[model samples]
Target: MAGTLTVWKFPTETGAETAVATVRDLRRRRLITLHDAAVVSWPAEATKPKTRQLRHLAGIGALGGGFWGLLFGILFFVPLIGAAVGAGIGALAGALTDVGIDDKFIEELKERITPGTSALFLLTSDAVLDRVLDEFRGQSPELISANLSHEQEDKLRRAFAE
Candidate 1:
């Protein structure tokens, strides 16, 4: 089955970290299944964001540090490196696109996840949409982006409608 790549943005820098607990609880209850997850915390005064992959939650087929590192580098570090590295960044970005994450997705993440914000990035499947979303009500997470198949997107929309 195709897993959904989702990014949820939170207003506070620590919000994503706090939501991790809720996600863990949901997983324990079988409300959702996560293949891999990561958090990006950007402080207001900081030059860049800090990223942490949830190693403990990673399953057998989960993506490793290398994937996160490359993604984060492309998202947060590429600008600082300048056009001199454009060629390399392009190649790396192409790799990401090959896996369903396109430029539009990356650009949206860059635009939304500004300083003083935090985002939870999840690679998941088999989610009980309504129940999973209900668990995050307290945090008020904004669904920034999601790469889901047509059927999955329809299911998500229906879940929200109800």
Candidate 2:
């Protein structure tokens, strides 16, 4: 099921940073999917812009701390549980880190945050627009985009065009 669309405007200097932060923020909000997002404007990468955009890291501190803390808690109360869970998590994180895209992904994300761009976050879910929009509106970023169907995005676009 789906509901009316909503969007949020978070100021940033780079479109790349906006994408990263939007992904991270929505995920934290328990959103599992994003319909679409585009950088309407971005400073040419070759020329560094003077304005700086606010940045957000995905599952960064919270995710990191939660992962490690879970292991510690289990380890403290249940040695076997801790050992198994800790090893599992460590391995997954390691594998993801070892993957070729790990460094590049991080570097790219870093590049997005440099300055003076804004990120528009698009969300698709069953929840009411006000439920989410109210929260972001309170934060007052830049502009929020809502309810993006491929049909609406491009008159000729079909459901599976992507």
Candidate 3:
């Protein structure tokens, strides 16, 4: 099945969590199929960062979970230290290219998703776009990136941008 990976950025961590909760509702209604998802948040007063991965879809062993773990580790965890450590993580990120997740995606996310904000990384298939978007009618969440066809991507961009 064809899958789409999208990142939705919100002004606040709670907003992102609310969006994710809506997605869970969509899933419950059988409007979408989610292969994996992750939430990354950086609260303004947080002494520590917060991240959550939907483990229900991870299944047995470490395949899906490990992928998100490594991705988030490079994106969130490694930066707490020095440039030297970041260099090593950069190398490790290059290796992830084989799995269709690359350094560019991570870099774009890091640059766009600022502190005091949160983002939802969604891996989904067979989604009812119209209905799903309807759930977000009042809110304007930035569409960071999506592995989608030009036409479909443009549609989603316009929808959310509206």
Candidate 4:
């Protein structure tokens, strides 16, 4: 089955880190199948976000550090360098687009995950949506983006609304 790439934004800098435990629990319960996960935490006083890949939890077919590095570079570093590195960043962004993470998704992430906020990036498949979402009821995470069909996305939005 195809995996879904979902990004969830949280209001607090530590929220994404806390959510990792919840995701682990869900995986343990067989409610979700996680291929890989990463957390991006940006503190209010920091100049840039801190990224951590859940290497211990990575399963087969997981994306390597290079993928995450290139993506994070495009999202957080490319703009800072201005036009000098535009060509290189463009090629990296294009590679990400080839894998379903397009410019719109990157832009939205850059806009939403600002200082004092955090985001959880999940590569997963075969989720028991209701059960898994129930585990995150009180966290108030916003579903920023997802590689899901229109119907699936609508269902996810409705679930979050509930």
Candidate 5:
């Protein structure tokens, strides 16, 4: 099966960074395959934070790059009252919604991940869920899984929404 695009929101930047590093360790041990990964950290003082693309993972292509770019664009580039620009971006985001990532989700994430928080965006496969969860047991991160069926997504959400 193709891997799912998963976003895990961590309450702290350190928690998110730790998750990414642990995933990297798993990848190094050949336990999982990470297609691409990025980390977003928004400090309380900064207006916006950069979404950093990890170096060791495979290419995420233009679609993934554009998706993240558009997210950051909406958060930092578009003017607050630029209806025309907002509509254009909305249209583009709507078009890409079928691709499994969209503006609505992005906006929801924007609301959920506030300043002083962080998130991990990962494209992964062959994950050992037990092991992965073990690494994060103490952190209690919130998960927002994408590219999954409604049932699957619901199950995942219920499992990690703590």
Candidate 6:
């Protein structure tokens, strides 16, 4: 059987929690498969700094987003000594935060997410687009389908063939 792989595009502003929650509810009712619920996220502000200095956060991801959040919280508390330590910790956090997604990763994703580019993509390999369409209907109302160019699709086929 020929399986259709759908790369559904969505608004970059779509909240991860909301999307996941909707899918989870649908799954509970057996409307879709676990595979159909897969998700990948790119910044909504693809061209701008997202979350915070994300463009420069290749330094932060290495330290892990959580670590910096912790350091920042610690810095916020304490007293006068906290100010100095907080600054140091924040510097470390910034350095750590800058390490997650590198410039190349952002550049690649951003190019794909240019003003008229795909903002979000949720690919599923199955023959149930109708089911998906019905399930996600009105949920992500602004989400649109990214029509892959023939060249793009052909390239994909060739890559998979190899």
| lDDT digits (tens) for residues 8-126 of candidate 4 | 78999999999999998888888889877789999999999999888877766566676677778888877788796878789767756555677888888999999999998887888
Candidate 1 lDDT over 75-129, as tens digits, reads 8988888897867888978866656678888898889998999999887888766
lDDT of each: 0.81, 0.38, 0.69, 0.78, 0.67, 0.38
RMSD of each: 7.1, 15.8, 8.0, 7.4, 7.3, 14.0
> Considering every candidate listed, which one attains the maximal lDDT?
1
Clashing residue pairs in candidate 5, if any? none
Find the 10 residues in a row with the least total lDDT in model 5: 153-162
Which residue window of length 10 is worst by lDDT in model 3?
Answer: 153-162
TM-scores of the candidates are 0.87, 0.33, 0.75, 0.86, 0.75, 0.34
Q: What total of clashing residue pairs does each candidate reach?
A: 0, 16, 0, 0, 0, 14
CA displacement after TM-score superposition, residue 156 of candidate 2 (Å): 6.9
Q: In lDDT terms, how accurate is model 6?
A: 0.38
* Lowest-sum lDDT 10-residue window in model 4: 153-162
Per-residue lDDT over 1-162 for candidate 5, one digit per residue giving the tens place of the 0 to 100 score? 455777788898666887877787777888776766778887878777657767566433312454556656675556663888788987766644555566667777878777788888776767766677676778878887667445443443333232
Best by TM-score: 1
- List ranges where model 2 is wrong by over 4 Å: 2-6, 14-19, 44-117, 121-123, 127-139, 144-160
**Residues 2-93, model 6: lDDT tens digits:** 22223344554444334555555654666643322223334544533222212121211122334323432332232335576767754554
Any idea what lDDT model 2 has? 0.38
lDDT at position 110, candidate 5: 72
